[model samples]
Target chain A: MKTLKIIKIGGNIIDNEAALSSFLEVFATINSPKILIHGGGKLATQLANQLGLEVKMIDGRRITDKATLDLITMVYAGKINKNIVAELQSKNCNAIGFSGADGNTIISKKRPVKPIDFGFVGDVKKVNIETLQVLLEHKVTPVFCALTHDKKGQLLNTNADTIASELAIGFAKYYQTELYYCFEKNGVLRDVSDENSVIREITTQSYQNLIDDKVIVDGMLPKLNNCVHAIEKNVYKVCIGKPEMLYDDKANFTTITK
Target chain B: MKTLKIIKIGGNIIDNEAALSSFLEVFATINSPKILIHGGGKLATQLANQLGLEVKMIDGRRITDKATLDLITMVYAGKINKNIVAELQSKNCNAIGFSGADGNTIISKKRPVKPIDFGFVGDVKKVNIETLQVLLEHKVTPVFCALTHDKKGQLLNTNADTIASELAIGFAKYYQTELYYCFEKNGVLRDVSDENSVIREITTQSYQNLIDDKVIVDGMLPKLNNCVHAIEKNVYKVCIGKPEMLYDDKANFTTITK
Candidate 1:
């Protein structure tokens, strides 16, 4: 089977210009089919603050009210996605930007109001692999922003990490898919502050032990869980680390195995 | 040759929620191959005002400095483009949103600085007919925002009307293309103040007569010129006026022909 790589980059890389440029330069060199999913950066909140829109947060997840949804849609899907596409294009990689609504590639369900109504937040219900497969087969790389649609004409805010995982699993049916969660830190550090103390590999068996030891707490916990979820779903491989880990296996990063 | 309809919607319809919805309803019913190109709405300027970004104008044309370019990219490509795609998706149009960078569909040259320095504005240079044909052949309708990329990784502001005309002309080589400029006003009104005074058909001979008589002036002149330009470039038909004119012959609109 052909191999496909699904890479996700968080705000730490996106918010930094030099870092994003370096990352794209490396990303352009991957000859295998790949998809890039990016998160909304600090610009949304900064713009929200500038416009005096109160960002309501419950349990750390952003409340995507109509206003917030609009803001993030503009920031994530528009400015950032297109810029990344242009950057990749300049590097000779044909990159296409997507908000799940485009091509009806991803249809999601709005989170039910009974469960702490996250407003426009969505849970993935389906991924139309046909459109994505067409682009990929044509050697086009898709750059997706953290957004989805309900097919009922409403845009929904989504987690970029979940999008990466969903796409990896969805494509795994046809290709040997590897998922990468590329962020700023050296993956799954033994000590959060010590960048060099990286955990080399993690299995489901060892995951709980690490969690219990408090080595992977806070935000890293959900991210690690996403990696494990992808692995359980038959994704060929999953990793979390700095973007450089793509070309450098020796780079400090955590590999997730089933 | 196969037939293709290329439609452009200006700000008047886009700035209005009800009007845009009605327009999309009709646009979705276009059984033939079609593409929708939309102009940036007033929301960009409004948001810019909210963010205290001064919009500079030179000789009635907005100068697209870096900040303004970013603002429009967000509003036009991000918000307006995606929402339109979602609306069309709900209507079962299978819509896909694009900034020229996507699939490298439209590559443009940044306007030269010698000519009054329009900042990041661009002039259309090439259109990748292959990508558009691929989508159209698959029954996918492309929804484009008025922005193009300079191949070297820069997104530039472009005129929606020009983009519409250019695409129609580009596709005319392979398809009998009809171009529509849909806005709120009735087509080429004999009297600007009188909505009822719509010109039925405008050929090269009559167009000059109208211009000489001071009937077509201001913004409508440039728009009519775009119509004539597309017509001269062998486009099958070019129409300008209300969006409903798409299906209704009784609808008041102007048709341009050589």
Candidate 2:
């Protein structure tokens, strides 16, 4: 069986045209089956500002109100979805972009943060893995934006980390795939700000220690949680590293172990 | 047989909070079966501008590029999808928000426009009526955003008018529904600037005359085209009127006829 890989690219990668092009080149050369998920932080923030809507954040997570959620759907699922598709096509990669809402691939429930209602933010409750499997079987790489539909048939804004994690678990359980999370940082650093001090490996004990020490904070915290969850679900491996170093054994990447 | 209706609300309706609330109140009162489709044009365009992206428009239609498309997906599918769902819920109406990509409900092909490439825009090629039917059967009003997915799994930015038309035709064919297009304007005006000069009805003959007189130009062209297409497809009626007058017989609405 060909090993399947699920990877996530960040807003940093998509915003920089040069980075996007170079990444596409590398993406096209990869021979194994893979899936790509992406984020649109800068775009979302900028749009929120333009619409005179104040950007809301709850514990570093975007508070998706009615206005902000509309902006997000347009950017992530509509615009980013197609742009990524066109970019991959230009690079000779057969990439197709979609969202969690497509084919009911990701069924979510509204995340109503009590005392503060985030109008459209969602926490994924279920995933229709079969839908994703069908797409992969057709030999097309699926690119997903982190947006999902609620029980009421409404689309809600979801965190990319949450989306990537859920999808990793979904792919792992369904296809037994490995999950690799690629970002700008070298890897899981022992020192959060020190890129060169990459932690070689993270055991269940070390993972807990890092959280206790308050080093793995904000966005990275959810990502780490996802890694732990993926490993717990018996995925082959979960790696956190730079995009180019994803496949390198000697690269500064964190091997998350159960 | 119970009558089915597909009502499309414009951005202008949503922009006004009081008006939206009033409209939703009236909408919830309707005992008949109905589906809602909506747009967030003003919000999307404003966000596009703040992101340093030049809001590109060719003859009033948004010329969607990579960045713009991303903005739109985030707003339309993500944010607006949730708002509508929340509003309906507030009115105790069972509503679900969705994008065309969801459940493969709306499948499309990337429209290859020569000279200027509209990055992620698509023309509606097919619709999954069964999925929608099942939802409607369960008494869930599916609120749809104008975003769609291509066969290649790419999400495309589509015109709201096009989406509404295709959806109307699909619903009409599948469940034999009435298609209602509600906008800020009273109806199709005989004179562009006069609000009271609403055309009561438009037939194929009058439509041609309007086009010949250049009265039906710009954004109205696509809308008129969609109206004609729906009528041609044997929709019971394609009614164009103001949001508040949707249920009123004396409403200045135009009916497109063969």
Candidate 3:
């Protein structure tokens, strides 16, 4: 089976133009077939503020009301996705931008109202690997925005990290898939204050130990959990770190495995 | 050769939800290999106004400055295109939305800054028919936004009518293409004041006569001219009028032929 790399970039890396351009330069050089999943940056929040739309949140996760959903759809799928595709194209990378709505590539279910209503948020229900395989087979790279559709005509806001993990799991059936979650951090640190204390690797056994020690808390918990979930679902390995981890073998990144 | 329909819908249909929905419903029923090209709706300008940005226009054509370009990319490619794709998907049409940058499907030349510096406006230069043909052969219908790229990482605002015509011309080599320009008015009116005076069929000779008699003027001139250009370029036929003309011959429309 051919090796496929799925890389997810968080808003911190995407928020800065020079950082994004530099990261894309490295991203364009990866020899294996790859998929890029990008998060919504600060610009969407800034634009929402300018438009007088409140950035509703509960538990640090956003509540994507219809207005916020539209804003992110524009910012993520529109401006950010297309710009990334264009930049990749300039590097001779054949890239196409997509939301899940395109080609019915990813159909998601709107979170039920039983719990706190998350408005238009969706949890991905399906990834049409066959549809994506067509693009990969043609050597066309897909740049995805964190948005999915319900197949009933509503675009829902989704988590970019979850999207990457789900995609890796789906493609794992036909390929040795490696998932990379790229953000501003060096890696999962041993001590919260010590940036240099990067944990090189974490197995399922050690992940629970870190969680018990309170070192793995907050946003890192969900992200690390996603990594473990992907690995369990047949992904060869999952890495969490800065975007440079893709190229530099010694880069500070935490590798998660069974 | 297979029959293909290339339809361009102006802002009139898109701005009104009911109308756009009705038009799309009719569009989804067309069984031929088809492509839909859409013009930017009034939402972009409305957004510009909300953002307090000046919309510069010369002789009714927009000057796409950097800000304007970003605005349209958001509204057209992000909001409008994805929504349309989602809607079509709900109707069981496997539609994929595209900006020219996607899959490098359409490449345009930035209009030279000779007499008029149109900022980021582009003229259709090339269409990657093979890339598009792949979608057609796979039963995936494409929905295009009126934005093209210069391959140098710039998305250029393009005229939707021109995009439709260029696509029709390019696809004519492989398919018997019919182009439709769906707009607000009934068709080319024989009398400026009479709504019922639609010119049923226009040939090269009759089109010249219509212009000689002062019937064809203003924006319709350029639109009708595109229709004639598509005819000369081997598109089997070109129709201009309400979208209903696609399914209803009794509906008012002007059919152009060489």
Candidate 4:
């Protein structure tokens, strides 16, 4: 199978212009077929504040009301995504940006409101791998923003991590897919404060033990679970670390396995 | 040659929700390979007002400084483009939205500051017909927002009508292309105020006569000139009128010829 890398970058890197430019320089150098997924940065919240739209959050997840969704659609899908594509193009990377609605590349369902209404938030329903494959085959690198649609004229807010995992799993059937999640952290740390305390490898069993010992709690749990989910779904490799890990094979990043 | 329809819809129709939905329904029924280009509506100006950004204009044309360019990028490429794509999808049309940056499908140069400084504005430099043809061949309808980019990582605000004309001229090489400009007016009116005085046919020589007779002046002059330019560039047909003319065969619209 052809090797393909699916890398997801969080807002921390995106919010910093210098860091984003440095990361794109490395991204342009990657040899294999690659896909990029990005999350909306603090700009959305800042804009919401300016526009007098309240930012509602429950358990660290955003409650995407209609206004919030529109704001993100404007910020994430529009400004950030296009800027990245133009930057990549300047580097001759031939990048094309996407929202889930574009070509119906990713169709999602609105989150159920039994517990609490998440407004326009959506969960991944399907990934149109064919459209992606065709783009990749034509040497067009796809950049995706964390927004999906319900296929009924509604654009829904979605999780970037889940989108990366789902896309990796979707393409895993046809390619040797490697999923990478890049954040501010160097890796999943044994000591959250000590940057050097990177866990080189993590298996499902070790993940459970880490939870029992309280080493992995709160926010880290859902993220780690998503990594494990992709691994079990036949993704050849899953890595969570800083952006530098993409070009540095010797880099110590947390690798996930089932 | 396969026929391709390139339709450009102005802001008045886009700004009205009922009219937009009605137009999309008719657009969904276009049997040939089609592409839609839309102008940024008053939403950008409204947002600018809310954000306290000054709106600058020179003879009805927006002077796109960096901030205004970003605003339109967010409005045109982000919110408006995606919503239209989703709406078309709901109507069973596989529409994918693009800014010139996406797939590098359209490339432009920053308009030079000779007489007046139209900051961050771009003129259409090139359109990647191969990329467009590939998308069309795969049954994907492309919807373009009026934003293009300089190769050096800068996004520029562009005029939608010119983009449509250029695209029609670009695609004319591979397909029998027809360009349509849909605005609020039914057609170019012989009497500016009379709705029934639609000029059914306008030849290049007649166009000159209309201009000399002061019948075609002001905003309509540039628009009709663009239509004539497209016809001169080998685009098979060019029409200017309301959106309904797209689906209604008996509908009278202004047709341009050389």
Tell me the TM-score of chain B in each candidate: 0.97, 0.93, 0.97, 0.97
Model 1 scores a C-alpha lDDT of 0.92
Residues A215-240, candidate 3: write the lDDT tens digits.
Answer: 89998998998999999999998998
Could you give me the TM-score of model 3 versus the true structure? 0.97
Worst 10 residues of 3 chain B by lDDT: B128-137
Fnat measured on candidate 3: 0.72
Q: Determine the TM-score of chain B of model 4.
A: 0.97
For model 4, how does the per-residue alpha-carbon lDDT over A152-247 read when each residue is reduced to its tens digit? 999999999999999999999999999999999989999999999999999988988998988888778888989999998999999999998888
Give DockQ per model, in order: 0.86, 0.15, 0.80, 0.84
Residue-by-residue lDDT tens digits, candidate 2, B195-253: 98988899978899999998889878888999998888877788888975677767787
Candidate 1: where are CA atoms >4 Å away? Answer: none
lDDT of 1 at A100: 89
Task: List TM-score per model, in order.
Answer: 0.97, 0.63, 0.97, 0.98
Worst 10 residues of 1 chain B by lDDT: B129-138
lDDT accuracy of residue A169 in candidate 4? 92
The per-residue C-alpha lDDT of model 1 at residue B20 equals 94
* Candidate 1, position A170, lDDT: 90
The fnat scores of all predictions, in order, read: 0.84, 0.21, 0.72, 0.76
lDDT per residue, candidate 1, A113-192, as tens digits?
A: 98698899999999887888888988999999999999999999988998899889899889999999999888889987
